[model samples]
Target: MDLTRDQVEAAVRALRPDMFDFAYWVPEMAKEYRVTSVLYSVVSATAIAHDLSPGSELGVPPPGYPSSKVLFRAHDAHALSSLSIFYKRLYHRMTTGLMNCDIISMRTCQEVEGKFCDYIARQYQRKVLLTGPMLPDPEKSRPLEDQWSSWLAGFRQSSVVFCALGSQITLERDQFQELCLGMELTGLPFLLAVKPPKGAKTIQEALPEGFEERVKGRRVVWGEWVQQPLILAHPSVGCFVSHCGFGSMWESLMSDCQIVMLPFLGDQILNTKLMTEELEVSVEVPREETGWFSKESLSAAIISVMDKDSELGSLVKRNHAKLKEILVSPGLLTSYTDKFVEALQNLLNDTNLE
Candidate 1:
């Protein structure tokens, strides 16, 4: 599979193989579990070698079996290894680079093949299954409702925007400061749910000096984490400025707030692709090489999204209502799970019969 340049560097430093030949040995292990060894790739693209023989790509197999070259679009590395004994099912769904339409039989997106691949993956590990956001059911979620409303009561009327940057990725100081300044420019109350930067004593280090004081009267609050779902659901939160992480996208969409996106790294770019091009519900900030976003640009994006007259806002709200009808339905999620289990059971039975 394609490994990002960053991922490759990490592998080189951590694995520290004595020779390049060490790479191909992974596929040999997969053969023992009925996996057909194919090409060895780098960065999920770039095929390093095809059906590389012993001593061809790798010097020799290790004590264990060769690793399978599994790809799951939505799954993190851990989820793939956990779900199937032989196959790896990715938990999320998105395009993985471009695919060949001319090819007779090949799938493009991984979500389509996730369960099937997961079945094969189970033949190897079969311990961990990739899962989606296990959000609390809206109907059953009670205390959460009260807690959310209580938090909302503190915000100034029509002044707050909820900001969260998913679970991964942090902003550098310049970016954070610019973002804060943008909030200040809006002259509205704001809630920034920020995770601290590495080795930093406080979030204020990344913020402009006097920012906290400048925005003091208008209910500017910052914390390492907030009950994100509840925050989005709050009536006072008129908009969302986010990193466009898929989970955050889904959360914001369901809550019916207009969204301004600032995506960082990996699938985030692709997620923005769908949001801006496909869904038409959100706006994205332009990112620079220095990883900095301008306060002016941020301010503009925020103003546009927050504007009630903007067509995008109404479109987002309408799309959100429709999406909620599907996403919040217990039947949809349960059906997917039920299908996954049935497939697994059928595969297991065949293996036993064999």
Candidate 2:
């Protein structure tokens, strides 16, 4: 259901007491049922920790903890302030969970976020466990939908550009039109799956005037959910323009497509940086000081990675290929799973001794 901010806050408050009760009940149930351990997701862990131990200190970072500037680079004071607030909230939540949990687990690997994981372990004085990327096994998933399969089959290999800005982002009308127009400017077939812009009832309603006629037969701007992983695996899909969500980040890495990013949220921005700056496997569409991106800039970013002769395109493709090989190597994922299970068993033994 669509909810206003006040409504959301009210709903959260209504649920808070029950949530706390559940958190407290968990420990009791564990004792009564002889449940040896409680493996909590980060958010749940935070709540349990708050209710069970309220005054635990979030200690100072260990030496060599990256400075704020290293973690994020804000262009201006306003941006910096926003980043600071967002990170402070995130850090507090994560640290609380890390402190309370018997085993700290993450859906990440040393190949990607090792340094950050190490920092958390040292700062929180806990053993942080990694679960690798935890990507879905594509083999077990259903095939791509017929309509998408047939449509994609019509194009030559690596010829079409595909863009999905995650399920949560809804651009303003003007910005939405700019995005559509930008894709059209790329002069390549594209599939743009996004929510209808703010104040618009449908994807058709939010289109720039005459936009459909101009881009017909070569573009699709759908407003509903589609099979993302299957679509990404299709042969004709060459480049991926994504919002850099965590799941999408791993998906893009695993695929053979060229990567371009446009991130909106705090974690998303960090994911974009990891791909574009640190990993050197993607190019980001730069935003202005106002956090606005123009059609030209958007088109330019896509083209930089899609063009055959573009040095940036070639560079990322090479780097992505190398990283993908490592991520998909035999037993890499299974090794993480195996280790995670072993860690849990060890924790159980330790608990029994105590």
Candidate 3:
């Protein structure tokens, strides 16, 4: 297929921009390449507007939404301000990119984040196009690894807990041991895939005393990557303890597993709230004022969701199942992609006419 420079630029820019220093170049790039559209994660878009817009009234809850439903509370603002210089620069670039783009898009759908999406569109005065979750097609992907398959098969259906904190989150040594011990306290079979904690050579070395012996044969604390989606799809995997990263959020939504969110970053915290509060599809482990979660809290959150008789468990399961059915329904993802393409084509045609 033949494509214009604008089309190629749009496609490349659709992937999230990582060059923090180049955010200032967005306007120049768009003008030079005639770039028709740009996409931003919904959280970053909202945050950019919140931080940059003059007299932005985001702190107040929208009508019909409770005070608890406000997207960014006072504490959230403090947290945002306290981020390291690197993140602060990254956010600044994201803000510039959002401000310069002719078209704004997100890798999410209205069903899950309609209110927030609408708020962003109103704030930016631009149409916010959603590309749905854009998850990978499991059918086309490779099968689960042989080791994981055989081990997961050993457990009863929907009985194993799988915890993966994504690649970026690295806990302190003590916090890492707490997390591992928390899984052990659940007294349920689990697979924990995470980076070795700070100051540890490997996950094995970071474990609590007697941890491996105490939970032998029932737990796997892997320090390397695992096939997360395929593991979540495994029959024996019932609960997913995730960090609520955007990709993991979609994967968790599409799977049948119960979700237990333990978000560590800024956007992750917002995603956790969206899952636990707005959608009511997942439970978040309670954190102290210092933003640390105890092993007991983690275990309790998992137990609450895993217990067959727990009311909270039943409620989230029912809600999650309903949402999953909609998300996985035939052509739902394709429909979003088709509409997004049509919008892009229309924008290009309008530009040509002008």
lDDT of each: 0.51, 0.73, 0.77
> What 10-residue stretch in candidate 1 is worst by lDDT?
94-103
Cα misplacement distance, residue 34 of candidate 3 (Å): 4.0
Whole-model lDDT, candidate 3? 0.77
Candidate achieving the largest TM-score: 3
lDDT by residue for model 2 over 153-178, one digit each (tens)?
98999999999999878899999999
* Cα lDDT tens digits for candidate 1, 40-159: 112111010111111221222122222232211332222223223221232111111111010011111123223332332332232223233334666676444464467578775544
Q: What 10-residue stretch in candidate 3 is worst by lDDT?
A: 16-25
Backbone clash numbers for all candidates listed: 31, 0, 0
**Model 2 segments more than 4 A misplaced:** 1-63, 66-70, 75-94
Cα lDDT tens digits for candidate 3, 34-111: 545465463433333334442433343333332254265444443353344435455456556667766677888877
Which prediction has more favorable TM-score, 1 or 3? 3
Q: Estimate the overall C-alpha local distance difference test score of candidate 1.
A: 0.51
**Residue 337 lDDT, candidate 3, scale 0-100:** 91
Clashing pairs in 2: none
Query: Which residue runs of candidate 1 sit more than 4 Å off their true CA positions?
Result: 1-134, 138-151, 156-159, 197-199, 288-291
lDDT of 2: 0.73
